[model samples]
Target: MQKPSIPRGTRDFGPIQMAKRNYIFNTIRSVYEKYGFAQLETPTMENLSVLTGKYGDEGDQLLFKVLNSGDFLSKTEENDYQVGSKALLPKIAEKGLRYDLTVPFARYVVMHRNEISFPFKRYQIQPVWRADRPQKGRYREFYQCDADVVGTNSLICEAEIIAMINEVFNNLQLPDFTIKINNRKVLVGITEVIGATGKEADFCVAIDKLDKIGIEKVNEELIQRGFTQQNINKLKPVFEFEGSIVEKLQFLTTYFAQSETGLEGVKETQEILKYLDSYKLENDHLELDLTLARGLSYYTGTIFEVKANGVQIGSITGGGRYDNLTGVFGLKDVSGVGISFGVDRIYDVLEELDLYPAETGAQVQVMIVNFGSEMTASGLSLLQKLRTQGIRSEMYPDAVKMKKQMSYANNLNIPFVVLIGEDEMKSGDYTLKNMLDGEQAAYKINDLISKIKNSH
Candidate 1:
């Protein structure tokens, strides 16, 4: 028989893994809802037109396109294939898996423009696909937990997103994280200062790699992209700028004196920092990172990226302000700011640090031991009662041996196991075993429910 396997960069989650994954999702969802963001979901696939061009050239190259279903080859000319796959793709594929939630949210807002209120706050937790090679903490298919508010340009929206980031990591018990904030305007300002004004996009793209490829390669790339050595020299201070948030802002203010757009970005970053001061963040610290140039072309204003304090992982979360995302979908002037929590990477961090709660993977709080056919009926009724009392539970399905039933419960780390047999059934009481401590006791039916619920 052929060995069973799944595609690379994909995973099959078992019971324990799913339980832990759900914990991460639930924690994030609750925080999103608490912040007045309503849940939204979009289809996993979007039209090629909607997804293409939105992510820039490299991003477009990574989109997973779905081929036409039937007779797909009929419309394709042999010469089209001979020319190149890129030339032939549009002939066969019309749709592609969604690359991210933000773009689709933009499309949704435009399509339902009539229904949505201004400053629509929505949260989406969904899987997105990319065709890129995957490695540790990076998968081709993974979930993005995004919260965005559209139709407003207030800095409060940006501030609240920062607060939400703090809340999420704190709730998840993440020990240390930094919320790096920067503005596209500030990046644009850098380009302006360096005299790379017309090539701002190329400048941002090259500088965004400072963390990935380091400053030397970034400088080389800037040179390759036609930035003069003189202009590249002007950008060195931006790479070297460091201090408290205030100090960084002061530097930018002086440096961007010539660029109004750059100064506007400086003011925006300062305002966001001031608003952030009102909150008491536990695990998240705000920093004005001059180098944080989110490479996405759509970002127009404030941008954010999050990194785990001690873990050597790529950003676990990122997003930014987009002034014109919806305009592309025919809904003009709808400004939105948002952030995305990278679920899979966060899971890896939690697992590597062993931070998940001990009981997170415990699906059933109680398990009833099946004594035999004679007692199965009573066990079923007792199991039903436990469930009705808001307790998660189950009974051993067959007339299994006592040792086997107890072993099964132990394996799942179920806290309590109730035994129902001739004596307990006749006495109108149940035998409950505290699996963790091996403490045994007897209780009336109602009392049994109370004890189990309270103990858990």
Candidate 2:
């Protein structure tokens, strides 16, 4: 028999893992709902045309394409394959697994434009696929909890997204995190200020790696990308600029004074900061990070990325503003802002810190030990009553040995076990045992429900 294995970068969650994951999802969903964002779901695959060119060069290469169905080679020109698979890809593959929720959401807004209201607020929690290499906290398949608002350019949306970020990590009881904010226009301004206007994409892509590869390699990359050494010299101050959020903003304001677009980005950042100051976030801090250029080509305005305080992983949440994502899909002039929580990475952070609440992984609160066939009926009756009371209880499926059934309960960490053999059934009561303390008592159905409900 062939050994069973899952694909690399994918995972199969067990019962306890799923429960902890659900806890994360449920917490995010509740916060999203409180913010008035409606839930949305998109298909796992999207048309190749809808996905390509949306995420920029590196992102496009990471898309997992679906092959054309049924004798795909018959439709391809023999000569096309000789050139290269990349050259012949379009002739065979027409669909791809979704790379992220934002692009699919853009398509949705355009297709359903007439049916939905303007400034539509929506939240989506779904698994997305990517063809990237797998590593710790990076997966080929993972869930993204995304919340977005479209059709409005209000800075309020950006501010609220920051608040939502704060709320989510705080609710999860995660340690200190920093919400790094930036503007694509500001990056554009930086390019213009340094006289590298035409190479904005290359510039952003290089600087975005400042955190990963450090300044030396980044400067080397910029030089290789054909930027003149003199222009590169001009960018040294930006690389070195640091201090409080306000101080950084002050420096950027003076630095980009000559670049109109850059100044506008500065103004937008200031406005967002102004609004954010009115709210208090317990564990998260907002900071201006000029180097925080989200490498996605689609983001035209504000960008955000969140990093956990003490974890050694990438951003657990990220997103930004897209001015006209829908325009690519034949819808014009709509703007949107969004953020996505990286569920898998967040799971890693929580696990590493041992932060999950004690009850988050509890699947069953109680179990009924099956003494024998004679007592099975009585056990089933009590099980039904307990379940009806909204208690997570189960009876042993078969009349197993007493020791074995007790072992099952112990292994499952079931806190309470009810032993309903002939003696207890005759007395119209159940023998309830507290697994933790090894205490035993007999109680009527009402008292049994109350006792179990009140037990840890």
Candidate 3:
């Protein structure tokens, strides 16, 4: 006999944990729905070709590949067995668990392009699998709550995304945070102006570690990554110039005035800022952050990352504009921008801050005590009545000790308990006890339902 266990990176959620998780998902879903984004779902496994090359090299390495069924290794040659996964993976793995919802979504749009309307806005809340090393606040299997608007390059969509982020965090009652906004084009423009356009990937990858590695160490990393002294000199201003976001933008506008792509990004950012102003989201809540480089290869325009102030968690959420993600799937010129809420990380933050509501548990508003066989029927009847009245009520399956049933209700944190012993059943009334304050009152079943409903 084998022991029962799950994969290391995966988690098994218990009832209480499920309740808390549902609170998070429902909060984000409600906000997504409010923004006119329809819900969507993609399969757990997608074709390897569909997922490959969408994320960066590092991300692709972390994807969980599924082995082909039915003698997967039967076709592998003896000589090919010694090679690395690069040469051997194709022979064994035909499918892969989805790395993220966004890539599968892009594939979805291309596959269903004809059936769907243009400028499609959709939201997906699904578990994605990764093969990364597990740690606190990092998992192999985690849920991503994503909302994206594709087929449109409108800045209004970007503003709406920011608004949706605000609404989600606000509804969750998360403490003050910053929704840092940047544009990938601006980073590209910086590389171009620095005469390192060919090394843009290396440059961005190095600077993306600015928070983890100091500026001097970043310059050293860039040098190690094959950047020239002249390019490093040009990049120094970005780190050295410290001021408000508007001042930094002013500097960028002056520096990259001639680059059309850079100027277009500026215009798009201006529109976003204008729309945000119309919505009045400016302040510490929404601000321009020049240092945000979302390391993903797909982002082409506006980029975003959110960080909570006074908390020590990583980016709680992030996403950006990708100009032509669907072009790889035979659809060209369709642009999209979206954000992903890192639900697990957010859960950690909320737990650390003690922000989760106390009442987050299974909704057993009332538990009916089971007496002997005679009162069991009465208790079941009362349970049905309470349920019919829109109250979440349950009863002990067996007629056990009164103390044992009450203990069960107490352990479950049920707010109220109903005693349906013989005396109460004969008197045509039920004893309703408030577990919180230990107050008891006797009332007819009808009046009891009404009182619970009205009081709640």
Per-residue lDDT of candidate 2, residues 1-456 (tens digit): 999999999999998899999999999999999999999999999999999999888999999999999987777887897899887998889999999999999999999999999989999999999999898889999999999999999999998999999888889988678999999999999999999987999998888888889988999999999898898899989878889888988898899879999999989988988887787654348878888987889999999999987888999999999998999999989999999999999999999999999887778999988777678777888888889999999988877678888888888778889988778878998889998899999999899999988876
Cα error, residue 237 of model 2, in Å, equals 1.2
Would you estimate the TM-scores of all the predictions?
0.98, 0.98, 0.96
User: Which portions of model 2 miss their true places by more than 4 Å?
Assistant: 282-284
Predicted candidate 3 versus true structure: per-residue lDDT over 1-456, tens digit per residue: 999999997889888888888999999999989888899999999999998888778778988999999999997988777787787889999899998999999999999999999889999999999999998768999999999999998889888888888888988888688898989888888888888877767776787788777888988988898889999897777667777767877888887876666667677888887787777754437767666787778999999899877887678899999988999999999999999999988888887888888888846888888787788888888888999999988988888788998899989989899887778967988999999899999999788998778754
TM-score attained by model 1: 0.98
Report the error of model 2 at residue 439, Å: 2.4
Model 1 deviation from the true structure expressed as Cα RMSD, one decimal place: 1.3
Give the winner by TM-score: 2 or 3. Answer: 2
Residue 42's C-alpha lDDT in candidate 3?
A: 93
Query: What does candidate 2 score on TM?
Result: 0.98
Model 1 regions more than 4 Å off: 280-284
Q: Give Cα-based local distance difference scores for all models.
A: 0.90, 0.91, 0.86
Which residues of candidate 3, in runs, are more than 4 Å off? 1-4, 282-284, 454-456
Candidate 1 vs candidate 3: which has greater TM-score? Answer: 1
